[model samples]
Each structure stands twice: as C-alpha cells, then as structure tokens.
Target chain A: MSFKKVVVFPAKLENLAAIDALIKSTAELAGLDARSIYAIRVATEEACSNIIRHAYQGIEDGTIECGCYSNMDSFTLVFRDSGHVFDLTGVPSPDLDSCLEDRKAGGLGVYFIKQLMDEVSFEHIPGTGNVLTLVKYLTPDSEKSST
Target chain B: MEYIVEKLKHCDLLSISGRIDSQSAPELSEALDKIMESGQHKIVLDMSEIEFISSAGLRILINAQKKCKQQLVAGELVLAAVPERVHEALDMAGFLPLFTIEDELTHAVGNI
Candidate 1:
C-alpha cells in the first residue's frame, strides 16, 4: 500500500535485468498477474533503456534509481536518472496509421510504454535529472485473467 | 545469450535463446548480419526458448525485416513458437501485426 523499496544502480545496460527482476518480485508480492507483470516489465525496460542510451548517452558512469510502490489496486514505478534532462513534451504522439515502410525506426519505445501502462508522466528537474512515473492499475479483469 | 543456427534447404533457422535486451542486442544484430551476408534471406527465428525481449531486440528484428525486404527475398523473416511472455511484448509494442508469427515450429517451417 506504500513505497516498499527503492533501488539505485549504474546506468549501464547490464543492470536492466536486475531491475526487471526486482519489479517482478515486487509486483508478485503485491498480487499482480502475469499479464500485468509483463506489461510493467516492458514499460520499465523501455524507460530504463532510454536512460541507458539517451539520458546517459551511453556513458558507463551514470546511475539510475527505480522506486516501486503499490497498493491493493495498483502499482507505481518511479524511474529517476541523473544522466540527462529529457523533456517528454518533445516527443510527438505516434501515428499508428503510418505505413510500416514510411514509419521511422525509433520512437516506438515510448509508444509501447504508453500503451502498456495505465498512466505515464514525465518530469524534468532543472538541477537534478529526468523522472518518469508509470502507474498500472491491478484491475479485476487482470487479476482474473491468466497467461 | 545463445544463438544456434541450423541450415535448411531453402532458409536458415536461427534459434535465439535467453534475454535479448540492451545488453545482448548487439550480439543478436551481428548474428543477423552474418546470416544475411550468407545470402540466406529466408529466416524463421525459433523464439520458443527466448525468455524476454526489449525494444533493442525489436529493433534488430525490424532491421532484419528491412534487410530481407531490400534483398527481395521470397519470404520475410518469421518467428516460430514464441512464448506467451514474448508474444505479449510483441503485442504491446504493436509488433504482432508486423510479423508473420506461427504457433509451432513445424508450421512455420512448413509454411515457408
């Protein structure tokens, strides 16, 4: 029902798996389902990978923090990174109607994150770094569904 | 991550096992490049053993698809026996429609 644990790790991509496992364990403890768990993992991976690639610009020395919270109905993950200040406002909404051949290669990461989670918001602290808050409701349907 | 290649009469099957994320994407991309260089454009990726995939992994797949299309291959890169978790990832990323997915390896191999 509240913030249980917060983990900080190097911005290196090697740490992504550890972060994924942490989120899975926390989501399981909060009684989320496989689909919900997988969604959270995808969303988290996109955000973290963005930090690893763009936020830190592939610098190995940067660090990222993942803070997880949950209640009976939902789970929230706050990803904070001290790599680069990312302005989420700059990202345009993806045009789903665009042809595959015409579509740009990048930009799908944030689109997928938006689709998987129930709520997503971005903040850039001028002095600190970028923070992305992602929330997914543990709906009754998700609880009842399997696989 | 482990990549095992099996040569077929008309195509080359690349079986990718383990997590293909930011850490392992480069390896997978390089493997795909090698396969393409060999002139075997028809590919059926046996993804049954892969436990997870990230956006980086998807980028590799997209690149491979583009390469195959550019080569004018008779068939595009296909995926066989994808696990539910991986399928969910593809679906969430809106990639399910982009791929020619099969539920069984036999079906994928036979179809192509």
Candidate 2:
C-alpha cells in the first residue's frame, strides 16, 4: 500500500508546530519507528526553517509546500518553496573533529539533515523555486511485512 | 515542548520535556538567560524527558554550555540524564565530549 499527502502553510515560525504535527501523524500512519519519525521531523524543520530564514529573508509572508509519501518499507518528505532560491549544494559540511569552542554557530541544521536521513537531495528550478527531498527506510520493527 | 527551571543549592536545574526543535528552542534559550542573569553559573540540564532534539536545540545547549563555562572558575557546565536520542545527537554533533554529563541527576547535582 502507498500513501501520499501534501500541505501548504505560511513560511512563519508560528506554522512550524502545525507542520511538525502533520509530519508526525503521517509518519505514524506509515508505520515508521520513533527514530525514523524524529529524523523526518528534523529534516523537514531544517528545510522549513531555511525557507523562513533565507528564502523569505525573515518576511514570514511566503508559503511552504510539504509533500509526504510512504509505503510499507520507506518514507519520503519533500519541501517546496517559491521564494529566493538557495544553493543548498554550497552548504559546507561541519568539521566534526573541531572543538566546540572553535566551531561556528550556524550550519549544523543542514549537517543533521544530511546525517539522519538515508538520502537527501535538492533541486532548484529557476522559475519554480527550490525543492528539498528527504527519504528514510523504515526499520524492521516499524515496517509491515508482506506474507 | 515544556521546560521547567528549579533552583538548586549551588546550581540551577532545567528540565526539558518533549521535542526541542527550531520552534521551541527560543523558550529554552530564554530560560537559560534568566538563570544566567540570576548569577547562577553552575547548571545541570536534565534531558531524560526530552524525546527528540534537533540541531537548533543543540545550538542552544552549546550556547548555554559556553556561557556556563565562561562564568565558571573551576569546572564546566553539567548535563544530566540525557536520553539516548539526545545523547546520540550530541555525540554525532561532536559535543558529547565537551561538557560534563552524568547519567543520574543526583550524581550531577552532587558533583557540581
């Protein structure tokens, strides 16, 4: 069985809770583990926060479209925004070896998104906007086996 | 997310329950600020009730740790009863070895 759903919300911090709840519910319906659900939620929040901070430049007036899909064994979350296009490809990876005092403040969100998800990809369509796709495989305990 | 701050004898204890993401991190930061302003340098953050934590939450913890370290004359900030999920996030983020973390709150408070 396959399930897919989408939602569009304003690019504001206030709407983040609703988005998080939606993703959590979707993950549950998909039969994902708590860790998998947490990963998805974190990645989605990073993408949404990026839009709110960089895309809208803190305007809080733009819109964010979130699309989620899941089957028996895996889940996917896609975030689309029609705002200032960001070059996610240019994001620098965090140096895990660096000490806490030497590490910079920002950039850890993208790093966590990269580390938690099984796969992460970004697409920027000039006229359309930015699309961030994240996927995670459900663990054995969370996946429904086919008889 | 919910956070409760309690005043200990020599340190302040902040207990965080629920998810700590970008949206709820500000509340934690504000609580940290209030504790710092109260001239409490020693702190024990009990994170056993936290189910999930993101990088934004990690950033706040790092900031709080740094603040406590700056104000500490002898020791560092203490984190107590951090759940496995939060521990993994902190470990992956290379922050596990930086702060003094205890598996029990009583041990942490007693050590501080």
lDDT of 2: 0.82
Which tens-of-lDDT digit does each residue in A20-70 have in candidate 1? 999989988888777788778888888898888888885679988899999
Q: Which stretches of candidate 1 lie over 4 Å from their true place?
A: A1-3, A141-147, B72-75
Displacement of the residue A9 alpha carbon in candidate 2, Å: 1.2
Candidate 2 structure quality by residue, lDDT tens digits, A48-73: 88888888884646899999899866
lDDT of 2 by residue, B47-110 (tens): 9899778788888888877877776474356889988767877887888778888999999998
Give the C-alpha miss distance for residue B82 in model 2, angstroms. Answer: 1.2
| Model 1 per-residue lDDT at A78 | 92
* CA displacement after TM-score superposition, residue A19 of candidate 1 (Å): 1.0
Q: What's each prediction's TM-score? A: 0.90, 0.91
Residue A103, model 2: lDDT of 65
What shift in Å separates residue B10 of candidate 2 from its native position after superposition?
A: 1.7
Tell the DockQ for candidate 2.
Answer: 0.70
Error of 2 at B110 (Å): 0.5
Total clashing pairs for each candidate: 0, 0
